[model samples]
Target chain A: MSSTLTVADVERIAALAQLELTAEEKQLFTKQLADILDYAEQLQAVDTSGVPATAHVLGEPVERDDAERPSLAIDEAVGNAPDPASAPGLFRVPRVIG
Target chain B: MLQSTASAIREDVASGRVSAVEVCRAFLDRTTAVNAALNAFNLVTSERALAQAAEIDRRRAAGQTLGVLAGVPVAIKDNLCVRGMTTTASSRILEHFVPPYDATVVARLAAADAVVIGKTNCDEFAMGSSNENSAFGPVRNPWAQDRTPGGSSGGSAAAVAARCAPLALGSDTGGSIRQPAGFCGVVGLKPTYGRVSRYGLLAFASSLDQIGPFTHTVRDAALALSAIAGADPSDATASREAVPDFAASLTGDIKGLRIGVPRAFVADGVDAGVRAAFDAAIGTLRGSGAQLVDIELPHARYAIPVYYLVATAEASSNLARYDGVRYGYRSARDKDQNLKQMYSRTRDEGFGAEVKRRIMLGTYVLSAGYYDAYYLKAQQVRTLVRQDYQQAFEKVDVIAMPTSPIPPFRLGERTGDPLQMYLADVFTVSANLAGLPAISVPCGFSEGHLPVGLQLTGRMFDEATLLRAADAYERETDWHAQAPAI
Candidate 1:
């Protein structure tokens, strides 16, 4: 019931997650990743029959009114940005899709 | 006066015996002294706590009324957001992230005038049974430095157990709060799902994640629950039912209560010390006039599997929001790549190893062709697990079991073996799946001097009954009073 997660698998996952893992991180993660997956596999053996799958336990569909409300000032939201001048109203990041 | 419970703190402020500022300073000082060893808190908001305390004092001086938990210092799990405070979820991904708003529980606690002392550490993204997954570092067991404080709410439990704060809030997806509480020898309750609002608490398993409290005593736990429990406008899934006064039912009276013992699930594979302590706890309850009956939950064996499928699937979806475009960490590389590459690179850089592992497994399970066999089948089994609890509750008022199978193991003992670590949560996972209210209260200490908790689970939304039983048990034994030697 145990499986080893390889470095390639880790790299693929990092790609999927939009992360840039260093080579050392990938190596360290290979062992740690395998251990976690092995642990999660323990759930495979439990018998669940007739038990209703609950997406949410509260069961009650809590909906809020879709009314518009005053929003946070744009400056306030971006005020804490490490570099506010890079982008006028949004967080500036490195160029993408070149 | 500073040692009083949240209820007493409110009363004292009202009666003018102590000022809110005085209470805040006392807890702040204690938190400072022990935080170095426990690593329980990621940040201590002394200035903010003092400011809030001063406001409470102003209201008291002006003869204005205060909420039930007025001026009580409470620590919140880092996963739960607080306005203008860092909500890291103990992961490197959100290491510099500061939430702009408060979680539903945080907002409610603030409304009640509860002074938030700081944010406590947890397993990264509430993923692990032990706190070792935290990127910041493992939170040491307050009771024993070498052993772990159970997680993902280890910091919260340790904070409460070490007397740093009388009360703390923690999230339990799969026994995060309860397991850590057990390891640290404190009272931790996981309310029925939706009993507390989940508006701003970081989602782990959207279905199972619940925020509850850790406290020194059962009564304290009840008071904290009352303050945080109730429906909220922000969380659409919040229960519409009125929250009862949990502290009002603290008079230990379970005269004809049918306490069910799940012979198949709880009794098997339990450590000898845990079993002895559990049996002794049952004997004490029996002596107290509570009837203990054997109940079989045939689907109990499948709880772990169903929990993982459902939890991981939902976690995969929920964690998808952590793209670098919106918030948190973004990869410095992959700039020239398309949106897909940007997303992949950001998430890979942001999330810790455990989080990435789960996302991958979830994606694989829910992928095309495998969905029906793995994800769909697991969902069907989840229904069965829920049914078992429903049927069991029809016959019993509450169920009793050992909170964890063994005492807190060494920090790195199970790190190398993931399955062994997941097995640690076996006894505590079913309650979350069933959306039942459960608590882990210190029952006894192991030979190695670690705390053992007796887990009491009750029917959905039946937290009062669980509290009553735990209060009665605490009355007879002084186990909850035993602190870690450190």
Candidate 2:
């Protein structure tokens, strides 16, 4: 099977990623992403019957004691915020709603 | 003084034969001298290095016992945070973002008393195979100014090769560390996944990323690994396995060690020089009393496809945190713009071409209708890749292959064709997929004099065996001793 990535699909994916691509990028990605996915279609040939998908290489879930420890201070947590000083302890962003 | 090994520097500083301050100065001077020609360092932390060095001297004067790495100078890949240092992953997004805390590995290096020389440049967000994707600029290979130092850990590898620092930290997600190390003719080790803590490493494909080191020698790689390999409460993924003294494991003996060589996998698409060097490396292993067995890793050839899918999927998710409101670059806004538009504009403006490409590819594969066809299929194939290694390890202690399919290519060589660049990692990505420890040691050079590496991959959490085999190979070859004439 070949990838048929179209401009509309590229726009949808870009929107999902919260990326504003230039018109040139959208056109370029349509062609490039298709080539990549086409190459990735090689996986379809492998009969992975009864195979389990691995999210991580390590098999077991790591568990630690439910314990309290010193965490990042409020100031340090927001230290790298784009607008750190304006809002005492919180990050300031553009208005979310009308 | 600049070419002194990490172990030698540690000993001299501890004995007061050479002050830590003096060693730091020598490396700082070397970095200043050669960095312009190589573009290896993104920022040199001179003040911090001197301060740390002086503190080491002060402690020694007071008759305090020095730490394992006492006065060794090391470079950090920009992806790993150094407290208060501008830790951009070589991307515009984080161009001015200074991390508030040091990464767990960085803190461990300090705990071992190693001096941090500076941060080195890398592929943006450690996303590309070549360092060309760095927003700052591409790092030139010391061997040939026009060729790429294999990356995304190019600067760290170049710095070690140029003798600016005895060691440098690099993270391997696909072939980041090993590929660069091979091209630079230095030793690069990627310890078992979860072997080294990744607490403050700017997340890039979390499941695959592993922190390791580039050093002038295999023993130094082993030494560096010992100082930073362990579990951390902050990183639940870090293994709880006992951190063995990796240096002690380098007995310079691989007698009767069984090495698996997948001749069929490496047969085609290999450069002639690399193939000859690999053959000689196998001969050397045999001459050293190590047993060689032919093995199969049928799924390894598919590593590039599987890696691109899984790695990009994870990258799309991890990088989603880089919205305009948080730490990092945010695009200037018009008054009426909303939050979503701000994030979009910020990422588009801040990210480089390759990073955007990966993010886009990642987002597509994980999209609703395509998830099972692409991402899930890739993961299942990933299990096949791991099982191949597991089956092979049952018969052999380690698997051997060329670190990269070909030697370092010219700058701008493969950048245009992303698929061709992905294929260069043909032999190296299996280690990451299988969570096995792997190392790249300089075996020989190409006809063009660019270096070629021989990679040895071992079972999970068995860095000792891998380090032992690499150290044993180093004992039999002088390729590691050769330095590029800058």
Candidate 3:
């Protein structure tokens, strides 16, 4: 069956998901997440021994010839950025630490 | 005019009886008056809408041939991009993000000469059952002010129910379209997965997500679907399935058709009044020359858990693109922090509780040690659920059940309990899991006057039979005719 998650588990999950939750959030998630997992425990009882996963239900991917095509302009792509006029006309972000 | 269906409006405009500009103005005025109380729309593009309407009128005046949905007013759920319009997906992160190009569906509406009035509200990233999870705010039910319009397409359903627009587009990943349509007493269609192109729709559970329409009548829903459903090169998954004349098939003839009702959906957990209405609808269908048969979808009981696992896993991967560096919300508190800190803080502040919770659950389930147990196992069960559907379909034309087990609950009733909210989707998630087309049509109302929907799940790309059955039932009853006092 499904295992109950701890507050420490929630903390680790939040970090892995790149989210910073407050203390109350951590506590709330600890309980709620465990409850959901427990509720989902019904799936554990089903025997899916020989069943294959559904990648695409009814259709197959189209084989389009990857030829040269027109694409979005550079300005239109970055027009919605928070800071569009950064040094190299690229998305500006805080520097990654070494 | 407000009571007229989109089909009726289309005919009137095409015949030059009512100008497109006049129809646009009426809808805009009605939206302005009702939107404040309903909280249905997040943006009303009045100037742009009127201008488009004027162009349609000008074209009509020039004796130009018109398309099917010539001048009907439509509302778009905020998740679908409509070039130059703010497509927020009801999340704070993309609150200011505007697309420079329109989604395939949005462009399809324009090609059909339909006027888009505004963008409707939704749950943040279309992640919740109740619209209360929206970062902007909750979209109130038009039927009952205290009740919720079932979400993430709550605003679209509300807009249609409130008569602010004759048609609106909604996306269904896990009952987002059908549940809200049931709550708001409207027709919501979740087209077969890949039947409609997902090119510019903001991704949410990509494997399960499909765009459909909400309308007052089944015919209108079919019209909207026909206008938008087709293959697109941008969406590689879009099927080259021949687009049938769905509206023509809604001839209200369901004689000798076999309708299956899963015995599992009729078990405990369904609201008493809802079950009664569902039974009554089945009886009505029986009286209309349709044979009702009991079907067994034994593994269908696991649809909810499987849907949660599959949907959350896909959502985690689909939503990972929203970092602070790009077009969406960035943390103002990121000045002195590192890049990772900025990403964390921006997402933490930008996304709502439900979104963050789903993301976390998804990440955890797909994590190394748990992937096989939760994610892969769920996929296997998903196959079983789909097999159940395939086996049942071999003996039946369409499967009928209650769209939502319960009617619209109070606004904050299940918001505090996410699992309870998840359970609300038990009856509707199987369609997404199986990649089948399903439609929720107004069947009856409960003692509390809340609308209940009878859902019909059809085989893949066989929405024709579903629409025919829904239209036949609608013709026999006045449920679709009954509107709220608001």
TM-score of each: 0.93, 0.99, 0.98
lDDT of 2 at B369: 86
lDDT of 1: 0.83
Candidate 1 lDDT, tens digit per residue, B266-301? 767888888888899988888888998899888778
Which 10 residues in a row give candidate 2 chain B its minimum summed lDDT? B330-339
Across all candidates, what is each one's fraction of true contacts kept?
Answer: 0.49, 0.89, 0.74
Docking class of 3: medium
**What's the lDDT for all of these models?**
0.83, 0.93, 0.91
Interface RMSD of each: 3.5, 1.0, 1.1
> Whose lDDT is higher: candidate 2's or candidate 3's?
2
After best superposition, candidate 1 residue A9: deviation in angstroms?
6.0
Q: Give the range where candidate 1 chain A is weakest over 10 consecutive residues by summed lDDT.
A: A43-52
lDDT of 2 at B382: 97
Reference-based lDDT, residue B299, model 1: 77
TM-score of chain A of 1: 0.77
Looking at model 1 chain B, report the run of 10 residues with the lowest lDDT sum.
Answer: B326-335
Model 2: CAPRI class: high
